[model samples]
Target chain A: MKKIIIASTSAMYGGKYLEYLQPVLQEHFKDCSSLVFIPYARPGGITHEAYTAKVAETFTAIGINVKGLHEFDNPAQAVLDAEALFTGGGNTFLLVNELYNTGVMQALEKAVHAGTPYLGSSAGSNICGLTMQTTNDMPIIYPPSFKTLGVVPFNINPHYLDPVEGSTHMGETRETRIREFHVFHRQPVVGLREGSWLEVKGSAIVLGGDRHARIFRQGQEPEEVAPGADLSGLK
Target chain B: MKKIIIASTSAMYGGKYLEYLQPVLQEHFKDCSSLVFIPYARPGGITHEAYTAKVAETFTAIGINVKGLHEFDNPAQAVLDAEALFTGGGNTFLLVNELYNTGVMQALEKAVHAGTPYLGSSAGSNICGLTMQTTNDMPIIYPPSFKTLGVVPFNINPHYLDPVEGSTHMGETRETRIREFHVFHRQPVVGLREGSWLEVKGSAIVLGGDRHARIFRQGQEPEEVAPGADLSGLK
Candidate 1:
């Protein structure tokens, strides 16, 4: 069975990195000894080694060993051999570019489909959707294609934010951007706010965390799905 | 003489559509009786005719007639024949896709380079840069290329905003996104705030409006250029 945790963000308000998700992660990785970390996203232009170490600092506390995919001679083979997998957040464009160029996107999809435990946050979580069309990241780089692993039926709009009342900023709101996405795309979009995550097991995808997630289907009104709600219905 | 007005937004805070810009636009389009308006961006999923009418209302007030490119059978030919041009803000990807698909990107570039008076706001202004890589719009559709008109020496990050103090939003700040862009591309970027604009005349590009603009250059600290400052030196 496929087991995965797709989070909107790695940290919550007033919290250290992954601190709020520690309890859930502890149980999530209980069966794994070590997992391969894909640090290709490199948030804030961080190097591969530095990003990997940052992730290791947190995973080590949960009694899990972390190995970066870059350490291996063959990244695709490493994904196939990993007992579990974790992909951190960063620029989605850069992440997708590296995944496609390194040929790890296909291999990683196969590993996850084969029931390897997986964890993803931000740009990492976005790849679980139909496409990267709804990502908030700038186009720092262009990927071979916007295609991603459709592990879930819908696209994940991570770090989803609500419109600020009386704000002077005129940029498109997160909701407006998602609505525009529906103009050209037919897939359903889940607005995953901070502190929220999707727990996928087998064919069941449940909403985790305390807040409700916003669900948007093409040509339909957006609705809020409560915490612990089964999102597999969206499929 | 390469006359152009690149605005951060079509509408400013508490102001009517193109209100603050009318004074400058009146002079910008003084010589032309009518101009071609590109509504390919289609903000908020508005139809081309509807968006064009929106621009037409504002231009008409300034004694300049507006004509949407879509009304013409040949968009490329219309661009070449335009006395002046105005491209409204909307989804950048959609606008870029339409421009490329219709083969008007080249024609528009040619027209602009030949000194046809041009005005662009938001996504429209974004394309006046070297590429649309710095755009803030969602990737609703894939464009044939991120490349755009190099009318200006660098890229423009329209609707640029600063990080809110004490805010907990985990999304990358506007500044952070531009810095990440420098990691792969070596081009200067100007963060134009709402109400601010760039006045490009011949070889000089001057900052206008009431606020300062942020400048990001590769391998250097970001600097703020005051309003009315001539930015031709950076070029």
Candidate 2:
């Protein structure tokens, strides 16, 4: 059975790091005393140790011990032995590249599937999808492949934003970019806005948080589903 | 002498396609009667023919004939023989993938270096840089490499935008993304704002339009350069 929480972001505007998800994480990892943290995504290019320490500070309040995967000599073995797991978010390209380079992407995926309580935020949540094709991050580095965990049936567009009603910026909006992804892919995409997440237990996946998630399926109009809605049928 | 016009966008907010660039393009390609357009980017996932037709409509008004590179049986040969070239904006990954798939990336680069008049907008302009790693487009498809034409010494972040003063979105801002790019790359980057362009005439590259361009160099603070400023010293 898989127990996972894939969140849109670790922090909300005007909030401290992981401030909003702390409560959910407490319950999610209640059965575990400590967890291994994968901090390779290093937001703003922070060092892995620094990023892990920041996550540790937050988990300390929840009575959970945190150790960065980088701190271990055998990261894949550490992931396999973790009581719980958390992957922080930053550059998806960097995350995927480092995961491949460290030979732990598959180990992490297997651990999550083997009933490890797993938490992912932003770029971390993105890898839980079918592919990283829909990520909003710049291609800071080239990964060996775009394939990801596929723990979730569909892809994720974390921190997904709606088009500004009257904006003049000519760049592609989040929706436009996802639609373009559909041009080359058939996977459904979940536009997970801030404050939203997918809660998975065993084979059941449900939407959590107060906001509505925008679901995008190829050849179908995008629809909004409220929190607590079942998302197991996304595929 | 190499001659190129790398623009931030093909269309500005609420403006007709290529309307803002007609006057400048009239002089840029004054010696050419026809130009080949690469519609591989295909913004909004429009068909190559449709995208080309839209561009042809604009160039028609400027007294130049337009033909899509897709219409040619041998794209590489067409690029080598083109009187002038224009690559429209779309997904950077798709454009780069198609350029490599059809074996035209190198030919296009050679043609541009051989002094063929070249015009690029958005994703097209992105390829004029050292690499496509700084592109804002979604990775709809994987390309063989992030390396690009290197016609310019630096990378380009086209359709560059400033952070919203009061927005609550937690996703990385345009500046943050570029800053992250600098972590792994030493090349300078130009954040080309909408309506701004880079006009290259032989060894001289100058910023065009009224807006200032944000320049990002490794290990240094970002600086703003006014229009008409020489950018040949970026490297």
Candidate 3:
């Protein structure tokens, strides 16, 4: 059975790194002593070593060891052999580009399907969907394809924000962007707000956290879904 | 020689479409009667005809006739023979995709280089830069390539927003996103705030409108450029 925890963000407002999800992660990786971290996203352009060390510090508190995927000579083998996997947040374009370039996208998908515990946040969680077309990140780099792991049937708009009331910004709101996405794609999208996640075990997928997620379907009005609701039937 | 008006947005907060740039555009297109409108970006997923109609209504107020590129038999030819050109705001990915798909990307670039009075807003303004990598729009679609019209030497981050004071949103700020882009790209980026624009005439590119623009260069701190400042030196 596959076990995955896809979160909208790694941290919350004024919260320490991964502090909000400490309890959930402890339970998710309880059986694993060490996990492989994919730090290719390199948030804020931080180096691979620096990003890995940050993750290591977070996992140390949970009694789990951490190893960056970049440290391995063969990243695919590292992912397949790891007891658990965690991909942190950053630019989705950079994350997908690195995943495909390193030839570990398939291996990670296979490892997760074979039941290795997996955790993803933000850009990491966005790749667990059908395609990265609905991401809110800038296209800092071009990837070979928009196709992703597709571990989840629908797409995810991580760190999804609501329209500000009486705002003067002319930029498209999150809902308007997702609605435009439906014009080109039929894949369902979940507007995953911060502090929320989707817990997938085997064929079951449930929304986790304290807030509600907005669900968008093609050619239909968006619907709000509360936490703990089964989202496995999204497709 | 290139005569271009690259604006952060077509409309201001609580303003009508293209209302903010009415006077600038009136002067920019004073010599021409009919102008070609590229409605490929299609804000809110509106039809090309509908989007063009909205722009037409605005241009009509300035004594200029409007025609959508989609109405032509050969889009590329229409661009080459256009008296004036305007690409309205919307999804950058979709706009770039259509520009390349219909073979108008090169044609429009050539026309602009030949001194066609051209106006662009938001995504439209983004392409006037070296690439569309700095746009804040969602990746609702994937273009064949990120390369765009290089009429300007630097990339433009349209609708540039400053970090909100004391906000707890976990999402990366506009400055952080642009800084990350610098890791892989050396091109300078101009964070064009709403109501601001870049006026390019021949070899001189000057910042226009009421506000200041943020300029980001690799390995250096961002500098704020005031209105009417010459930006042609950015490279």
Candidate 4:
């Protein structure tokens, strides 16, 4: 059984990491020993120690032990030590590039499939797909260009949002992005909103968030669905 | 000889079509009686007649009579009737969508390889590459998800430009788009600037334009290049 909780980001507006992790932090890690972070994506480009310390601060605030992945050097052993793993957000492109370059992507995917509880936000949520083609932003950063973890068959369009009124940027709207995706593909994309998330436990998929999920299939209007609902559209 | 000209647009900014057909254009079309116009892409959502007629107006101005594919019910006859083919610009996604839907892409590819002179602008130029993954506007209007004409091994990011300063929108920049493309695959992308184009006659491949061309190989800065330039970078 696969166990993963992929989220949009670790913050809602100005909310801290704890705010975003509140719902899942305790429930998924009641028996976990430590938290390891992969923070190669800071705008300032933080060191692994500093990035992990930040996560440690958040974990300590909630009375849990935490560490950064860099400390161990052996990423596979680091994964072995953790009962659960938490990946923070920065730029999706930046995060994915580092993961590919350092071979952390393969390690993380192996660990998660081996029963480690995987938690990710924003860019971190993005790497869980078969390809990064569905990302909402431009696929700008390139680091070795390896395929992603392949957790799901479809692409992810992260930070998915409705277009602002009367914009002049000359790009397609979110709906069009999804539709264009359909042209290249035949799979259904779960247009996860800002607060929405996908929770995978064993073989079951559950959605949790404040708003309804928008599911887009080929040749149809995207429909809205709620938490715990069966994704008949997905199949 | 496979005669191909990848242009920036059917009509460049502030310029009429065929008004600027240069030594290269004349070199490709010794006789231009049967010209094919593929106008499936409409960012402005213009009709096939309107877009195709606009292309014909340009060729006729140059004393080369042209006909749109829509003038005939069957597109194969349209392909067969052409001494030369000119695909106009609007939206690469829409253009390719219509081509794939109508099965004109395969016909055009066959015609070009069969020795017909092929001329294209903007969206038309984009279709020459392996995929429409890097076109300028978001394929928000339609899916450009065709196998494409495949004259070039790479993708074409048309109307390529750097971002303006003080912009509020946080979407990915043009450079970012190219990099994002590299993340998924190892193909080089031709960042054909507005004035830049490609002229293909038999074994000769020429990059024709005013500005320096930008080519992105995986994990490197986009290298600057020029017209009649060698594109071993593309392979």
Candidate 5:
């Protein structure tokens, strides 16, 4: 019975970090007294301790204690032993690099599949997909592979954006980029817009939050999925 | 002398492909009767022959014949024997993949460095830098490496855009993305706007076109280099 919350972002427009998701998180993480946080993503190049403390300040408000995985001697064991787990957003390349280098990727995947309550935002949520091929982040560093935890059936395009009308920029749009991904990859990609999230319980995956997500399947027209839509069929 | 034109894009806001730069190109390739074009990037997933023909259409107007490297039996030899060269824009990952897979990366770099008049746009221009770390394109495919030609001293962010004034998007801005790149790499990055280009004549790299280019150096404030500004000091 896998339970997970894969969010598009940690913060939304003019909102405090994780503020909008706290109610859902409080209910989702009700069974756990403390959670092991994976701060390897290091948004803005912040230190592990600092990022963890930032997360701790939020979780503490919900009567849940938080500890960073880096605080532990063995990160693999930390994931295996965590009552609940949460990974914050940052550079996906950096996150994947550390996950592979520290040999914690397998442990984290196994623990989550074995029914640990897991919450991931942005880069954290991206690792739940088939691959990081759809990520919108820069390639500041290369990981051993673009392979990620296959907790979900398809790849996720977190912070998915729509093309601006009448833009003069010649760069590929978010939609165009995804189309290019399909030229080489067959995996379906879920363009999860900000304020949107996927709630997973066993084989059931539902779209939550205020907006709609765009589903892109190979050789098929992209379709808009409204909030509360069941996406388990995609798997 | 290494004579090259690394442009942000092949076309401007409302212009045809290579239209605005025709005069400059005519002068740049004055003595060359024909050019070897690398269509490895394949903008919009176009075929090699089709993309080459498109370039041929543009060059034919300038009284220069165009031949795609793909048409040659040996791409490396074609590059070495060519009087001039051009690489078009598309997905950088795809271009880099073909460059490494076909063993043309080294040959192309060698030819360009050995005084060949070369032209690059978008993804092609990005390869002229130290690495493809600053490219605005999505990672549609994995390349053997991010290492590029280093024809120029630093990295380039082609089709560079500014932060929208009142946007609610949560994705990192172009400037923020470049700043993030500086966290892991010390190489300076030039945010080349769509209409801007770098005119490389020997060691003198001058910013060209109407707009100012944004320069990002690690641990230093970003600076705006006006059009026609000599960037030889950077090298």
Candidate 6:
């Protein structure tokens, strides 16, 4: 059984981000002895060494014994040594490129299916989906293809929101974007809002977050998903 | 010489939306003789009768001959007759899905290449790309595929924006999303800020708006594009 814990933050060590999320991460990986952190998305320049280092320090203080995988450029070896893999979020494109280039994404998929604990945050959480179709970023550079790491069956929309009032931006609203997503992707999107998370343990799915996720199937009005709801219904 | 004018709104007559985009529409298509509105996206949700009289009234009041082409269910004829086609903004998924399902996307593509003067707004602009890879919507639903009416060589990030100061929203910022778009799409994205537009006349690409549209390319810093600037440099 693959125990996947997709969070929204890196470790705090002595800091706090989404303070509500810390307990959930700790409780989810209580049994794991060590957690491996992969921080490769800094390439797009959204992430910095200071934040990554802080993540390392935070995990170590919590006794998670976290190590940065950038040290082991070898893709196969990184997977072989990791007990529980934790991927911190940065830019999904940067992370996806590194994983595809290094073959670490395929390796992690193998390890996850083989019952190794896998942890992911924002960009990390996005890679868990069938495609990175729900990412809210622009394509600044070019790669071989637009496909993403297909670690999960559904699409993941991080920081999903309903439209806010008095907005004059010419782009479609958040709801409209989701509706468009429903029209493009054959799969359902797990609209994971900030401060919320989804945990999968031994085939059991649990939703954890402040706001319930919004799931939209084709041709249906979007429905609200509360915490502790089962995602199998979405599947 | 295809003259495609992608506007910011359509005549959503009977709804409170027509007044919202009237001035912009008037200024853009003031001299255009004819216009064809597409409701193919609504499928069964909207009937032909429901959209025609309403859209016709508002557009005709502006002195432009408006024709809602629900009668020509045939995609080929629809593309052949419409000299100036203006695809309105709606759910892009539904729009692209119907276009693909009825095989109208290619028909539209043919007309565009033949210089039929295609004018698209939101969803309309999206269809002009290699693929709708840079859209800022959820990926919940899937169509026949992720294919679009490849009019423009690149993708369009509709309703694009700069990051708001002290905004609590968490996700990739506008700048980052465009950068991620670069990773997969080597073709530069014409980040059309809301109320912003690009008019292609003969070979002159004119940026029309009060903002700078960024051109995202791989291995390079994105360049800010201004109105009346020669876009040949982008190509």
Span of 10 residues, lowest total lDDT, candidate 3 chain A: A164-173
**What TM-score does model 2 score on chain A?**
0.99
- How far residue A214's Cα lies from its native spot in candidate 3, in Å, is 0.9
Model 2 Cα shift for residue B56 (angstroms): 0.8
**What digit string (tens of lDDT, one per residue) describes model 2 on residues B1-235?**
9999999999999999989988899999999999999999999899999999999999998899999999999999999999999999999999999999999999999999999999999999999999999999999999999999999999999999999989999999999999999999999999999999999999999999999999999989999999999998888
TM-score of 2: 0.99
Q: Residue by residue across A1-235, what tens digits does model 3's lDDT show?
A: 9999999999998899999999999999999999999999999999999999999999999999999999999999999999999999999999999999999999989999999999999999999999998888899999999999999999999999999777788888889999999998998999999999999999999999999999999999999999899998898
Model 5 misplaced regions, further than 4 Å: none
Give per-model TM-scores.
Answer: 0.99, 0.99, 0.99, 0.57, 0.98, 0.73
Chain B TM-score list for all models:
0.99, 0.99, 0.99, 0.89, 0.98, 0.82
Which tens-of-lDDT digit does each residue in A1-235 have in candidate 6? 8788765444222437435566766776777767777787653453445545766676666678766777676855778678878777776656776778887877888888887888787878888887776765533322334466555667777777667666656456666665665554567877777777888876677788667888867678888989889886565
| CAPRI-style quality class for the chain A–B interface of candidate 3 | high
Q: Which is superior by TM-score, 3 or 5?
A: 3
How would the docking of model 4 be graded? incorrect
The order by descending DockQ is: 2, 3, 1, 5, 6, 4
Measured by TM-score, how close is model 6 to the native structure? 0.73
lDDT per residue as tens, model 1, A148-178:
9889988999999999878999888999999
Tens digit of per-residue lDDT, candidate 3, span B1-235:
8999999998888888888788898899999999999999998899999999999999999899999999999999999999999999999999999999999999999999999999999999999989999999888887999999999988999999999788778999999999999999999999999999999999999999989999999999999999999998999
Please identify model 3 stretches exceeding 4 Å from their true place. none
lDDT, residue A157, model 1: 97
Interface RMSD of each: 0.9, 0.6, 0.8, 7.2, 1.0, 6.0
Distance from true position, residue B227, model 1, in Å? 0.7
- Ordered by lDDT, highest first, the candidates read 2, 3, 1, 5, 4, 6
Residues B1-235 of candidate 5: C-alpha lDDT, one tens digit per residue:
8999999999987989999899889999999999999999887678999999999999999999999999999888899899999999999989999999988999989998899999999999999999998887777788989999999999999999999999998888989888889899998999999888999989999998999999999989999989999998884
| C-alpha lDDT of candidate 6 relative to the true structure | 0.67
Model 4, span A1-235: residue lDDT tens: 5688877656665567557667576777766767777776553345667778878888776677887776767765676667678877655556777777676887888888787888877667777766655665432343455256767555455556766566543344677767765665666777777777777776667777776777877777888888776552364
**Residue A135 in model 1: shift from native, Å?**
0.6
- Give Cα distance to truth, residue A133, candidate 1, Å: 0.8
